[model samples]
Target: MTITKKQITFSQAINDAIQTAMAIDKSVICYGLGVTDPNGIFGSTIGLEEKFGSQRVFDIPASENAVTGVAIGAALDGVRPVVVHQRSDFSLLTLDQMINNAAKWRYMFNGIHSVPITNRLIVGRGWGQGPTHSQNLQALFSHIPGLKVIMPSTTYDVKGLLLSSVFDDDPVIFLEHRWLYNQVGLVPEGDYRIPIGKAKIINKGEDITVVGMSYMTIEALNLIAVLSENKISCELIDLRSIKPIDSKCIIDSVKKTGNLLVLDTACKFGSVASEIITLVVEECFSYLKQSPRRITLPDFPVPTSPALTSNFYPQDLKIMEVISEMLSKKINHQKQERPPISMHDIPGDWFKGPF
Candidate 1:
């Protein structure tokens, strides 16, 4: 089936999703820090207030917990609040409402009440963001029950998942990687909803099953060419929705390939990577030709220095080494072209600021 498409950046797709949702449902209100500011939360929330008016699209105070409580209250009263936190670290302050109230309102009331809210949390590493600002805490949110945790990688998935999260009755944690804002791709025009808890198989192959989450998906995609050159057919799966992982898709792929390599944006310990590995081990241990492996940051805080961070995060060279060991095949790393950027911190030359 052919999809109606237009070339747009990841951030534009997010803006389009919010605009489309608010236009369709008057009850859907977007308000958070920098919503009304000039940057418009890295341009995703731009022009929303002007088009939707102050009552529907406005700004909130710096109090994360208080703003979250207000959003939850509004959601309980039939409002679908889209709250945006500039950084995922800021969201730590609102866990009381997120974990206890927003996530549990529907179940706590025995389906009598539904808190349909979407919290957009931006997470990434770059430009000396340091330990606190650059945290991938999706696992923390995913551990909680009654919440939908989504980490979309593509422009198409981001918009579709955001729309789905906005409409769903349960509270949703929408995590966006800052580096992906400028990445462009063909996205459907409007009103498309990719179902929650479904993983997308990006590339089909036989040698190994490689799963990546958030920005790590992009990283994995970059290695496909080199892997292909070495006759390593990789089946790439993007774990878009973290909370309710698509176990069937992963298990089937692993059963076919008899190998699994997971790449996670979060730390190594007790991460989404670990969770997927455990699922495969429990469901399809007999199908494995070798032990499953994962590539993730060390179980420690992210360093601020570029020199430290360059090696701190999982490098493509390291990934190739692991794949070589996993499949007992060699990958020609010299043939792999490095990313076109002056520094490792910035995603690309198009990147402009600290937002």
Candidate 2:
């Protein structure tokens, strides 16, 4: 396993992960909607079919449930299938297959059999994706037993986690935020793996514990500089894995900081954010200095208009405001920074959409 480093976008890292996995394993297969398209699902699947052949990397009809069922069957028969859904909302069509069968096959068989399937569900907010097209369902999937949910925010983690998911002997819900596809970072060359069920402390501070998932992690990171300047030290935790969440890391952080703030991409009600707050309250209630707080989208369908979408999606400024209130400090909006309201519908100016 030779290791070198180079800058790459989040989506390229994903493509590299799948390419590496398929290159090393004969049984690893990749298939899903728009997989073989020229655009290659935002270039994450480009050149895969040509490199590995259509037998292993092919397109499927838009029957998500049936396709997922077939993939689960293949996994049980010793094939590692990586199924990609263009939108996380599209995954709703396959819930019965995912929750009932794929997630329980190993347990139902007393651990003798396993479903080595990886479902890559794309999720995000942007460009009038609206309610139906842009839904963050990490919490919904994390509720199922025997299923591992992963949401990798950075380029490095995405590659490592995807590789791990593909090779794991159980079902893995690997979600990627569409906005993160263009995020560039230093990714190690060659194959490597980040263990499932682990959280990473991206920024360390003694004031507050901020746990974020997927794109929310990026938002949390952006606040570190402003928060620190205001004498508010923030300990930022990127929850790389949603289910089998890193309880020890979160508990330890809250014990030290005594304040908790969770930023989840999902809705406010019954979200992964709620689960994290509950865990902190249960494990470190006495250690907390203030009540745990979570910043999430309101419990309503996402609006399509740019004006509404701007307020719908929580960003760094919102996190800053929440942190200020939690710490009893006034927010200096003049010192805070954010993408212009004009670009609120997209992640950044660089975002040219295929949506």
Per-residue lDDT tens digits for candidate 1, residues 1-355, read 7768999999999999999999999999999999999989999999999999999999987899998989899998999999999899999999998998988888888999988999999996788888999899999999999988999999999999999999988899999999899999999887999999999999999999999999999988888889998899999999999988899999999999999999999998999999999999999999999889999989889888888888887866777889999988877767636557888888888875565
All models: lDDT?
0.92, 0.92
- What C-alpha lDDT does candidate 2 achieve relative to the native structure? 0.92
**What TM-score, over all chains together, does every model reach?**
0.97, 0.97
- The sequence of per-residue lDDT tens digits that candidate 2 reaches over residues 185-302 is 9998878999999999999999899999899999988878777777888999999999889999999999999999999998899999999999988998999998899999999999
TM-score of 1: 0.97
In model 1, how many backbone clashes occur?
A: 0
